[model samples]
Target: MTQDLFHPHRHESHPKIISRLKRANGHLAAVARMIEEGKPCLEVAQQLQAVESAVRNAKQALIHDHMDHCLEEGSLSQQRAELKAISRYL
Candidate 1:
């Protein structure tokens, strides 16, 4: 099958990224419950921190994977554009 030239390449790390996001999602929900239950500020903050870290790592993985897999096939301008797109999140 012919690969589409315009679309970015698939990153092999996507499944791992998805799994990390899923775990973060569940953690975030639990954090909300902690808030509703009037849990200690320190505990809630720690859980929030964990959720944020998980999501951040997933995002970093995706962006790095894009640079590794997708950027290799593109023109210099395309790579710069893609880098700019992802940099806003960083």
Candidate 2:
């Protein structure tokens, strides 16, 4: 299946995005460990929710950066691309 274009080219091209994702990865691992260790379900759910929120913020940051750096001109194509990017979140 095709993934969202919101973060396309991020893994190979953007160091900052990768760094943010690595942090999120650590959060996910911690959440998983909490579940495995029989931590309270509500607590683990909260941690997982935090991870999701962090990822959403990371994606928003990436989109904002792309607007500033990759599509600075604010052209129609850029708008369309950004729409496509943002659509992934829906």
Highest lDDT: give the candidate number. 1
Every model: Cα RMSD to truth: 3.8, 5.6
Candidate 1's TM-score:
0.83
Clashing pairs for model 2 are none
Per residue, candidate 1 scores C-alpha lDDT tens digits across 1-90 of: 125879744657988888999999999999999999999999999999999999999988887777666766677887788778878986
Q: What is the C-alpha lDDT of each candidate?
A: 0.85, 0.76
Give all TM-scores, in the order shown.
0.83, 0.66
Question: For model 2, how does the per-residue alpha-carbon lDDT over 42-78 read when each residue is reduced to its tens digit?
Answer: 9998999999988887887776666555554467786
Q: Which pairs clash (backbone N, Cα, C closer than 3 Å) in model 1?
A: none
